[model samples]
Target chain A: MELLVFLIFAFLAVAAALVVVAHKNPVYSTMALVFTLFSVAVLFILLGAPFIGVLQVLIYTGAIVVLFLFVIMLLNIGREDSQIAGHKAQLFFALLGAVSFGSLVILALSSLRPKVLAPLTPELVSLKALASTLFNEFLLPFEIIGLLLTVAVIGATVAARRPTAEESAATAAERSIETKEARP
Target chain B: MNVDVVVTVAKIAVVLGLLLQVAPIMVWVERRGSAMMQDRPGPNRLGPFGLFQALADAVKFLFKEDVTPAAADKPLYLMAPALALLPAFTTSVVIPWGPNFTWDGKEYAFTVSNADTGVLLFLALASLGVYSLVMAGYASNNKFSLLGSIRASAQLISYELAMTVAVLAVIIPVGSFHLTDVVAYQRTNTWNCLLQPFGFLVFCIAAFAETNRLPFDLPEAESELVAGFHTEYSAMRFAAFFQAEYTSMAALSALGCTLFLGGWSLPWLNYEGMGWLGVALGLGTLLAKVGVCMFVFVWVRWTFPRFRYDQLMRLGWKFLLPVALLNLIAVSAMTLAGWL
Candidate 1:
């Protein structure tokens, strides 16, 4: 039963991932990306990582993808330009990058044993055990990641802050001048 | 195995049946309660105390013509209402309706799916709830609908941060994300509302925003946005959005009851000692608590004036987020000091 479900979702994830890249509309591509993420989450649950699965959905599909959708709609992003196909050299470089990344992943996986890779033991993936492992063994990396996220958030806030009073006044003056010119 | 499947099916049936009933009945309450507050007769002409008013509205919704805009994205337009209802139905399954009971020598949990990641599951669904509004607005091909959805997306996402952290304030001391653990913790330590009033306050306020109730309901502010995301919808489609709103209100209220109000664990009510009678008694208590929450939802809506868009954003981010974080820290400190 588990294998069957895994196969179904694995196929779904692959198809959705393809759609994410290939879809013409950016908004539709984001929706397809949600499907891919959700399928991956289901795969995580199948692997006895329900906590990770839920987090995957919570963080990726729920939060990040929603933001992506918001931007796509707010900007009214249109279909992908067909002119991208004109760049053969760029396409060659992209394939070269993809191949190198795939090879690197394969090389990393080759050194790991199957049992070591995914133990599939409930104890390993359970919330308490995961928390202990993260805090004890991976605490530095986790804290560093948290710090990185905080810094990024602060940067974003600083970048998106309201313009100064003079800046707004200048813009208002510019709009008034443009309006006056159009009226004449 | 057969019994397990049967029990799950039964639990789903009961939860869905009760949840679906909450929508129509709450609409009745909203109308009648608002009318009573204003010294009016309300919809008493339909049936006994206007009991059948919801039914009449449902019938009218079903018969009304389902209109689709010429430029609307057809598939998404059709899917939005169903999407809206999905979270409402799914989030309630983790909520324990009554205490566990043994029948036929087999123990059965009151909830439908008592998964280990129950709270996380609820949060995931809560995060996705905005999609329906976004989809509705984006697909509608109408400016108002699009703007409403944009506001909804931002508002829900912002409030979700505060709500999730506020919930964690309670869950931190409990040391588990399980709903049953929450109820059990409350049973031992008077209700959580008394213990962490700040958490409760932040949670209730965030819950109001999460469910997009009034004061925070800028997404569908009728005067400004002309019915918001569902402006282009009509007939049963519009009804679906309306029902989704009420159903979600019921879900969030039930969640609040579980999180803060001791769930089915009523004060001076020892259903646990009542032997087999605890099952029915526990369910009754929970329903009653949920009923009170529902009334509160209506009352707050009628009582509060809607907040301006920036004010709503400011409240969610500047006020609620910081307060929820403080509550989390306080609770964590108390837990560490063996106070909680």
Candidate 2:
């Protein structure tokens, strides 16, 4: 039953992913991406990581995708215009990226020992176990990732912040000096 | 199916049944409560004390023309309302509304799907509710509708951060993501409101913002957006947003009651091991707490003036976010010190 459910959602994820790529309208594309992300989240649950699955929906679909939609809406982007001349370059890069990712997946799979993981049971996959694993084993990596996100947030804030009056006045003065030099 | 499967299905049925009734009950409460606050007659014409007003409203919504705007994107416009309503219906499952009971040598959980992630699933589903607003606005092909959706989406996103952080405050001390664990923690000690005052305040404020209640309802302000994202929606479609809002209000209230107010828990008593008596009393206590929470929602709506759009955004991002973060840090520190 779990395998069947996983198969169905995997199919949906791929189809919605294709829709995300192929759809003309940005809004529709984003909505398709939501379905894809949601399907992936179901796949995560089936993998006995319901915590990560819900986090997938919460962070990616909920937060990131909403930002994507927000940008699209605010910009009022219409349907993408097909650029025939750009197709060749795009196809080349897409194929190159896909082949590399596919190769990486196959390599990782072959490198792993067959049946390395024990069969998942409810008790084995409890929240307490997950938390201990995260905190004890993967603590450094987790904290680093969190710190990286904090830096990114700070960077975004700095990049998007408007100029204060003094800074604007200094820029104005620089511009005036440049004009003076050009005139002289 | 096994007994567990049958029991889970039955629980889902009961919860969904109760959730479906939230709209009418909340509608009545909001109208009458607002009426009393405003010193005016509310909808007493439909039935005694306006009890059947929800029925009349339902009939009106159902019988009226389901409108499709001339220039609207037909599929998405039609799709938006169902999208709006789905998360509202589903999020209630994560709420542990009643106590577990033992009967006939079998232990039964009160919740339908007591998944491992628990409350995080509620957050995920609740966050998805934003799509309905955005889709409704965009598909409406009207400027006002689009603007309303944009505002609503922005407002929800801003507040969601604070809300999530505030929720983390509760989850931190409990050491589990499950709502049942949260209630259990409260029962062992005091409620989160008494312990984590800052988190409770931020959560309550963020809840108001999330539900698009007054003071943070710039998105749906009549003068600005003309009924907001559902402007082009009519009849059942319009009622879908209405129902979604009320149901989400109930869901959030239930969440707050569980997380902060010690859901269904009485300070003076314990319900465990009391079998069916525990179930009845626990359920009643939860419902009563939820009712009080809903009353506070309506009371605040009637009392407060709406915040300006910029003020709303500023309050969410500049104020609530910081306070929620600080509260989380405090909770974490306390937890580390074994104080909680």
Measured by TM-score, the strongest candidate is 2
DockQ, structure candidate 1: 0.65
lDDT of 2 by residue, B252-326 (tens): 999999999989888989787687788889988998999899899999998999998899889988999999999
* Candidate of highest DockQ: 2
Cα error, candidate 2, residue B326 (Å)? 0.8
Quote the positional error of residue B145 for candidate 2 in Å.
0.6
**Each candidate: RMSD to true structure?**
4.8, 2.1
**For residues A57-138, could you state the per-residue lDDT of candidate 1 as single tens digits?**
9999999989888888888765654226668898899999999999999999998775646545667667899999999999
lDDT of each: 0.89, 0.90
Label model 2 with its docking quality class: medium
How much is A77 displaced in model 2, in angstroms? 0.2
All candidates: DockQ? 0.65, 0.80
